[model samples]
Every structure is written in structure tokens, then in C-alpha cells.
Target chain A: MIAELLFAVFFGLLLLGIHRKVIARIQRRPGPPVWQEILHMLKFSFKTTWIPKTASAALFVGVVLVAIGIWSAALFVVISGGSLLVIFAIYMLHKIVEHGFGLSSGSPYGKFGGVRSVISAASEIPLLVSVAAIAIFTHSLLISDIVSYQEVHGPLLITIPLAAIAMYVVLISKMPFGPFSIVESKELVSGYKTEHFGVWRAGLEVCNGLKTYVLLLTFILVFIGSLPFWLTLLTMLILVITLSFVCALSPMLSPYDSVTVQTLLAGLMLVYVGVLGVMS
Target chain B: MKKKNALALTLVAAGSGVAAMALSMASILPGWAYAAVLVLAFPLFVLGLGLYWMAREGEEDIPFLGY
Candidate 1:
């Protein structure tokens, strides 16, 4: 478990670094070094951290801690081969963390981000529907069991391509770019994270890195089947690189448009799952 | 100054935390020790970073400037 956590943090940071590099290359501009994120984190540790005078101090700090804790627990679940149901639940709880971060701050931008997070919660239904489809096909909800089933029956991607596509959309939306990033849209000046700086912001960065690892790992386990640890990490890195290119090439969508697209994807996924459930 | 000392301490703590994590992952330590280090690593990193940030001199009145 310790090893898994360390791997997630170390490689997760590297993943973000690679993402930045990829985006920079796509834009034909010289980007920060691949180790830029690590340097950023180190520099942040030496900077000043302070609570906003106008904000709710307890909630502001609490949200950061909660974000870290949630991602840590999710990492543990993935590493320990825990139930998919619990993983899905943690994914939903993440919305609460996002909402709390925004609402705790007094800034109107933060409030807007919080409301957008609420709207984005609609994306969760598609994620849940994807999980349901996997459970039905695998005849189990435990991640280890699902992996074992995949080993015997081949990868789930071949069996249910629609669910894979739906999961991929969910994963891309969680990233910082593309049409789904309205919560932290640039117009809101970084949105919920506008006021977070120094160490608190550092904490958020670590949390995000871990969140990315957990979500990508989950996708691999369910769709690609289990592999050795190194292979799993390599596959995830490749996926992150691919997603970064997609992000760099796409434009940001309006908040309403993002919600509409995500909700429609979720609805389609749910209907597909319903059809499959009946057939099976 | 006091702030410099705090920042130094923060650096030591954060560096140690990262080292412990790496050592544990490499499996150089006993199981119990590895578990203990794992538990301490993240909190140590966060606390050290937060303290270093908080102990800086002067106030940040400008946007997007300062430490």
C-alpha cells in the first residue's frame, strides 16, 4: 500500500509535467521543463501561506484537508483491490469537496465555481452507469473480481465499447482542459482555486495529481484488465499523453454547453446499460 | 531571522518525507516501519510546506506576486 501511494504521487507529478510539455509542444511554444511541477511544488513549500481575511477560515482549511483525505482514501481503495461501489461513492464525494472549496470562500468567482460544480455533478450519473454495466458483465462489484473476470473473458473494452467511451469522456472532463473545465474557467480567474496560494495551493496540486492517478488507474483496471505494476503505470502514462493532446486541440466549452454534453452522454450511457441489463 | 529558521525546518521536513516515501517504495525498510513512514509522509509534507509559506516576511498585498 505504501509503495502504491508513493508511486501514485511520484508518477502522478511526472504525468502532470508530461501533460504540460505536451500542451506546450502542441501550441508550438517552448514550455516549462518536464520537472517544472516538482519545482513549483518545492518553491511553494518555501513561500508564505495565509488564510483569507474575508473567508471562513475553518471551512477554507477543512476543504483542503478533506480533498487530500478523499484522494488518499480513493488511492487506498484502488491499491487494496476494494469494491467498485466504494470507489464510485468516493468519486461522488469529490463533488462535495469541490463545492465546499468554492462556498467556503466569499469571492463571487468562487461562488460561481461552486455552482458550476453542482451542475457538473450531473456527469456522475454516466460514471455510475458505466460501473453498473461493468458489474452486470463481470457479475461482481469488487475491483479484483472484475479484473479476474476480465482475465478469463478478455478485456471489457472489447465486450462493451460504449462503456469504455463513456468512461473515457468522464476521465477527460476531469482534466483541466477541453469543453468540460467550466468550474475553473479562466474568466473566473482560476475559479475555486483563485484565492488558494502557497502551501494550501500546493496541497490542492498534490490532491489533483493523486485524483488523476486513481481515476486513470480505475479505467485501466476495469477496461484494460490487470497488468504488472510497471505495465499499468506505463499504460496510464500513455493515456495521459493522449488526453493531453486532445485537451490542447480542443476549445473550452461554455458552462451550459458542457453540462448539456455531459448530461446527454450520461443519458445515452444509462440507456445503453438499461438495454444490456435487460438482454443479459 | 525566525522566518528563515522556520523555512529551513520546513525544507528539512518536506525533503525527509519525500525520502521516506521513496525508501519505503524501494522496500529497504521493514514492513511496520514502511507503514509508519507512509502514514507520516503526506502530513509531514503538507505541514512543512504550510509552515514555510506562513513564516515568510512581509505581507502579500499585490495579486500574483510574493512567495
Candidate 2:
């Protein structure tokens, strides 16, 4: 378990590093080293961390703990062959953490980010729908069970393409770049994270990395089937690279626009799931 | 001395948590032990945060948003 946590933290940061490098290369520039994020995290940890006087002290710090806790739980669930339902619940709870982070800060930017997060919570439904679609096909919510099913019937990506597409949309939106990143948009001055600094910020960074690792791992487990540990790690790396390219080429959308597109995508997935339900 | 001790305890707790999980992954420890470590990890982390808060030199007077 400790090894898995280390792998998630280190590899997750590496993914962020690759993301930056990929984006830089796409724009015809040399990016920072892939280890830049790790350096940044270490730097943040060494800096002074303080709470804002005007903020709710308990919630301000509590949210960071919650963020770390949920992702850690999700990582454990995924690594230990736990239920998809539990993982999905953790994913939903993450929005609360983001909301708490924003609301606790008492900043206008944070409030805006918080509201946007609420709007984005709509994406959770489609994510649930995607999970339900898998459950329908596999007849189990257990990660191991789903992987086993895929081993016999081939990857769900081929069998249930719409569900895969829905999950892809969710993954894109959850990632830092892309249209759904209104929570931390530059115009909002880093949005929900505007007030966080030093150690608190470092905690958030680690949470982000864990989230990336867990989400990608969940994707592979559900859609790509399970592989040996090394192969799984390699697959995750490749997927991150592919996603980084997509993020680089895409343009950011307005909050309203992103919400609209995501909702439509979710609705489409639900329709597909419903059709599949009727057929099966 | 108290602050330093708290910091050390935080590190120790975190390290033990990681070590517990690692050992479990390697099958050297029982699965239940890993779960127990996992349960303990968050509180230890929170304790560290609390100690850090207590040890922090000063508080930011400025509001989160420059009002």
C-alpha cells in the first residue's frame, strides 16, 4: 500500500510535469523539466503556511485535510480492489472539498470559483451514468469484478463506446486544463486556490496529483482491463501523454459554455445508457 | 522543544503510515494492518496540519480577496 501511494504521488506529479512539457512543445517552446512539479511541491512545503485572518480557520484548513483524505481513500479503494460505487461516492465528495475550499476563503474569486464548482457538480450525474452502464454490462460494482469481466468479454471501451466517451468527458473536465477548469481559471486569479499558499497550497498540489493518478487508474481498470503492475503504470503514462496533447490543442470555454457542453454530453450518455438498459 | 517534538511526531506518523502500506503491498503485512494504517494516516496528517498551524509565525491580516 505504501508503495502504491508513493507510485501515485511520484507518477502523478510526473504526469503533471509531462502535461506542462506537452503543452509547451505544442506551443513551440521548451518546457520546464518533468520534475518541476516535484520541485515546486518541495518548495511550497518549505515556505511559511498561514491562515487568512478573515477566513473561517477551521474550514480553511479542514478542506485541505478533506481533499487529501478523499483522494487517499479513493487511491486505497482502487488499489485494494474496492467497489466502484464507493469510489464514485468519493469522487462526488471531492466537489464538496473544492466548494469548501472556496467558501472557506471568503474571497470574491473564491466565491466565484465555489459557485462554478457547484455548477460543475452537474457533471457527476453523467459520471454516475457511466458507472451504471458499466454495472449493467458487468453485473458488478467491484473494480476487480469489472476487470475480470473485461478480461473475458474484452474492454468495455469496445463493447460500450458511449460510456467510454462519457468517462473521457468527465476526465477532461476534471483535469486542470481544458474548458471546465473555471474553478481555477486565470481570470479569477487561480479561482478557489487564490488564497492558499505555502504548506496549504502544497497539500492541494499533492491532492491534485493523487486525483489525477486515481482517475486515470480507474479509467484503465474499467475500460482497458487490468494489466500487470508495470504495464498498468506504462499505460497510465501513455494515457496522460495523450490527454496532455488534447488539453494543449483545445481552447478554454466560458463557465456557461463548459457547463452546457458537459451537460449535453452527460445527457447524451444517459440516453445511450437508457437505450442499452432497454436492450439488455 | 514542544514544537519540534510535534513536528517530529508528524513526520514519524506519516512515515509509519507509508511504511505500513508499503509492507502490506509487498505482502509482508496483513491486509488488515494496511487498512488500519490507512485509517490512521488522515488523522496523523490532520495532526501535522494542526501542529503547523500552532507553529506558524504569524497570521495573514489581509482578507483572502484584497477587499
Candidate 3:
């Protein structure tokens, strides 16, 4: 099981590398190799590190532990086919981690990143709607039941693609360089991640890698149903490629614009859920 | 001393991982026991791995004495 955690972290890092590579390629620029993210993690790990002078000493350190802990918990939840609600809660907590990270640093840039993370909290609502849509259809919030449902009824993608779209939007919003990614935009000097250098940064990268894997896996299991291991990875790659295209081709939106887009998407998701509620 | 601290943490993390693995393979144990180990093991692994790397050789500074 611990081995599986390592696998998810490494594979997710590779996926993130793939995301960066694809985005760079789309703009006619040569990109780093697919393993760059893994190397990046290693590089960050070996650097001398200390808490920032102006930071809240305990929260700064505590938040990194929380980031890893929550994600690992999410991984276990996903793997055990546990409640989707728990995953949603963890996703929500991740936003708080971001908000906390910024304030912990007391850096202007970090604080702004944290505030933006809060403002962008609407991005998380679409995920709740996606979960709601899934619950409405399957009549159960457990992931195992949902996958079994796909087995019988075919993938949820065909029955209610709107939910999948909403979910994908949620995924896109969390990814780097996507339209709603204002928190980590270049100007913030790495956003909430600004002060978390060296081992702390490496830990964050591990969390990122795990998060990428868990979210992609959840999407596959929920919408596409189960497949062989290799095939599942291929599907994840395809999904990442699709997201990379969006991140690559589209310019990052301003915070207000990002919120507007999330709001519109959220409204649409709510309407779909409402319609489904009425129909069923 | 800092190096020893890093090594100790890493060893503890590795020990936890080993314990978790062994406990998982044991059919006699209840499922919750393995979960209990996981709750302890995962953070130790992450923190151990992190601090292990963060520790620098030959860079031990004088301890900051509160004025």
C-alpha cells in the first residue's frame, strides 16, 4: 500500500511533466523532458532549508505536514473505494491549506496568493456539484458503488456528460496555468508556495503528484469505468493531454474573470443537477 | 547531530513502512490495525524523507541563544 503511494506520486509527477511539456510544445517552444518534475523534486529536496524570518513558525511547518497528510488520506479513500464525500472534504481542505500557507509566510506575495485562493474558492463548488450529480445518478456516494454502476449501465460519460464536464472543469481549474489558476500565477512568485522552499517544497511536489494521480484516477473510475492498469494510465495521459491543450492555448484569466468563468460553470452544473433531480 | 537527527527520522520512517508492510502481509491482524499503522506511517515517511534531504553536512551553525 505504501508502495502504491510512491507509485502514485512518481506517476503523477510524470504526468505533471507531461503537462508542462505539452504546453510548451503547443506554443512552438521546446520543453523539458517528461521526467523534469521528478528531477525538480529531487533538486528541491537537497537544498538547505529553514523557516522564513517573518512567518508563523508552526503553521508554516504544520501546513506542509497537513498537505501531505490530507492527500495521502485522499489516496487511501480513493483506493478503498470509500465515500466520495470524504474526497470532496479533502479537496476543500486543500484550499484551506493554500490559504493557510500564504498567511503563514506573512509575505505580501504569499498573502495575496492566499487571498486569491480564497477568492477562487468558487472553483471548488463545481466539484461538489459533480459529486452531487454522481450521487443523483447512482443513488450512492461510495466510489465502489459508482464504478459498479458504470459496469452495469455503461460509463456515466454517456448517460450524463454534463457531470463529467463539470468535473473536468474542476480538474482544469486546479491544474497549473489553467484559466482559474490565479493563485499560482507567475506574479505571485509561486503563490502560496512562495515561502515553502527545500524539503517543504519537495513535500508539496509530492502532494501535487499524488493529487494529480488521485484526481485523474477518480475521473477515470467515475466516468470511464474500470480498465486494465496500462489502459487506465493511457486514459490518464489522454486526459492530461486534453487538459494541457486547454492550459497551453488559453491565456490565464484575471482573478475576476476566473471567478466569472467558475460561476458560470457552477451555475450550469447546478442547473443540470436540478434538471436531473426533476427528471428522476 | 543534525545529520544524526535526519538519519534517525529516516530510520523511523523506514521502520514504519516496513512495519506497515509486514502487518499488511499478516493474515492474523484485523484491517483496522493496518489502518492505524498507515495513519502513523505516511507522515513519518513524508517528513523523514523531507528532513533527511534538508540536513546539510558541515553547516551546523552555532545555536541561537535567546538574548
- Each candidate's TM vs. the true structure? 0.86, 0.91, 0.94
Candidate 3 TM-score to native: 0.94
Candidate 1 segments whose C-alpha is farther than 4 A from its true place: B1-45, B52-67
What would the TM-score be for candidate 1 when compared with the true structure? 0.86
Model 1, residue A270: C-alpha shift (Å):
0.8
Clashing pairs in 3: none
Give the per-residue lDDT of model 1 (tens digit) for A233-262. Answer: 899989999999989999988999888888
By summed lDDT, which 10 consecutive residues of candidate 3 chain A come out lowest? A48-57
On DockQ, the candidate that comes out on top is: 2
Chain A TM-score, structure 1: 0.97
Better of 2 and 3 by DockQ: 2
Candidate 2 CAPRI assessment class: acceptable
For model 1, what share of native contacts is present?
0.18
| Model 2 misplaced stretches (Cα beyond 4 Å) | B8-12, B15-33, B46-56, B64-67
Residue-level lDDT for A230 in candidate 1: 88
What's the lDDT for residue A72 in model 1? Answer: 73
Rank by TM-score, descending? 3, 2, 1
Candidate 2 structure quality by residue, lDDT tens digits, A152-259: 999999998888878887888887787678898988888888887777777888788889999999999999998998998898888888777888888888999988
Query: Which sequence of candidate numbers ranks them by lDDT, best first?
Result: 3, 2, 1
Best candidate (score: TM-score): 3
